[model samples]
Target: MDIRFDGKVAIVTGAARGIGYVCAEMLVESGAKVAIVDILADTLAEAVETLGKKGTVKGYQLDLTKVEDIAPTVSKIREEMGEIDVLIQVAGILAGNPAEKITVAEWDKVMNVNSRSVFFMMQAVTGQSMIPRKSGSIVNFASIAGIRGMKEPLCSAHYSASKGAVVQLTQQGAVEWAKHDIRVNAVAPGGVLTNAMKSAPPEMLKNAIEPIPLKRLSKPEDIAAGVCFLASDVAANMITGQTLIIDGGGAVVGV
Candidate 1:
């Protein structure tokens, strides 16, 4: 299917690198005017510069953990890029510590970025743009860790909890906003081979890939394809409150 955004505008958070970056690039390639957001200013600038060559792309450097900053940032994007037609919340963090040893600060940090900010961003964007317009699509980043427990060394209780929150949030948002023609869904990925995963300890990487039926880690493009499908109004018009798992069949084997 040749999905296209044409004249739409999209906001993609955590788009400085990894799966987030690929999603933003695909949106641009599909003809959407994209606002790529990230806390990493330098990296975001580079991404903006590179994506600019392909289509209309802009970078916004804002820390999603700062809940207070979300509303204003959304407002700026609306004013600069036009009312957002699509939102892809991909900003998240994974800190691995045993549940028993997890500090309050560490737990809070993960939740703040992965769960809380996601809610507020949706609230701000929908209230200010989509709700008023009565049309939009949102895709949140969930994880396989959220869907099921993992025995991997890097799986942290807080990270899993945060993603679980995301899954619930996506469902609630989908139901609540369906009246306004807004669709909310999530993509749960397992062991994606992004830059961070590339630098992971050999044992950790091996552990991640061993259980998948496909016996391979997902590429960033793999997850991006799912995200773009969810974000497409035409393609996913009837899809909502769903968590599309792009785990290379790991979930099927109970990994």
Candidate 2:
């Protein structure tokens, strides 16, 4: 089936590279005007330039961890890109440490980036754009680690805990915003070979792939397709507060 987002204004955080970049690209290709946000200004600019060649795309450099700045950033996006029609919260950080070795600072950093920022971003976007318009779609990035905690040397307790929060936040936001015509959902990916994952030690990478029924790491495009589906009104209008797992059957295999 064909999915079209003509005239939609979309904001995709962490759009500088990997999954977020692919999401933004897909939205543009599907006829949406996209504003791509990321902490890396240079990379964000490059992304915008590349995606612009395909369709309308702009870049914003912002530190998502600064939760206080989220509202203002949303304001800026609405001002520059027009009222938001869709928001994909794909900006996240990964930290791995044994529970005993994880320091307070490490835990706080992970939580702030992975969980707290996501909530506030939604608040900002909903308050300034979606809520006022009474219509929008929000797709967040969660992880398989969040659904089921991971063992040592794979995922830190902090990362897992933060993602678990994302799962709950998506549910809460969806329930609270449904009356306003806002849909909140999340995409939980397993072992995607993004730039970060490509940097993993060979042994670590091997261990990650072993449990996947597909026997291969997911590509960024795999997750991007899922995000596009959730963001599409014609495709998922009735779907909300759900975490769609795109793990190559890893979740089914008990990974």
Candidate 3:
């Protein structure tokens, strides 16, 4: 692949496992120093052990949902490791039920973890470093469900709406940050295999896939690869405020 990030530093949130872990591994292998941030305290330590072989890897166990936690965590990384060149947001939550059955607590939890954290984390990272440098990239992990209503809605109204918010948030952030030379883009993925996916019920899974053109689920690496492209200047030089749909062309139908 002609891409090499020999002198860059990256932050991959929710890196304890799944796509976030994969993103961190990919970035480090491509020659960028990476910090793996996750709320899973024990698992974060294990991720560092595996991902630290290439370049440099730092492990941070922080709950991104805490409004005040992101800034200081980012500050600590910057204080010790110089500036971050890339920030990949992969933390997310999904709880699906009929809208009528979805409780307020469920809705709030999904929005706060999946959508709200992205906003604050972006503010902290860009606020403290990227914006001023006028050169950095932010890759958000939005979902295909964000672009359109799920063909088979497994999640309640809130999950889809929260992802939709991420899509617009990416656009807004991109537009506002472009002048700072920072790029913000999102990878809206189709059904990807992850720890989270295993929790879905058979009926919910069936509904989620019937409309996908590919007729098959997406791989975590598939989504991670797209995220890496967006984070790298080589692939997304002129791209910003755009949501790259990696959905097996599902959006072609109605999305």
User: lDDT winner among the candidates?
Assistant: 1
lDDT winner between candidates 1 and 2: 1
Worst 10 residues of 2 by lDDT: 149-158
Per-residue lDDT of candidate 3, residues 102-206 (tens digit): 888888888998899999999999999998888999999888777766644554688888899999999999999999999999998877867778787878677
Model 3: lowest-lDDT 10 consecutive positions: 147-156
Query: For residue 94, what is the lDDT in candidate 2?
Result: 83
* Per-residue alpha-carbon lDDT of candidate 2 for residues 202-251, written as tens digits (9 for 90 to 100): 99899888888889999999999999999888899999999999998998
Q: What pairs collide in candidate 3?
A: none
lDDT values, one for every candidate:
0.94, 0.91, 0.86
* TM-scores for every predicted model: 0.98, 0.96, 0.92
Sorted on TM-score, highest at the top, how do the candidates line up?
1, 2, 3
For all predictions, the C-alpha RMSD in Å is 1.0, 1.2, 2.0
For model 1, residues 126-215, the per-residue Cα lDDT tens digits are 999999999999999999989988675766999999999999999999999999999999999988999888998998788878989999
Which residue pairs clash in candidate 2?
A: none
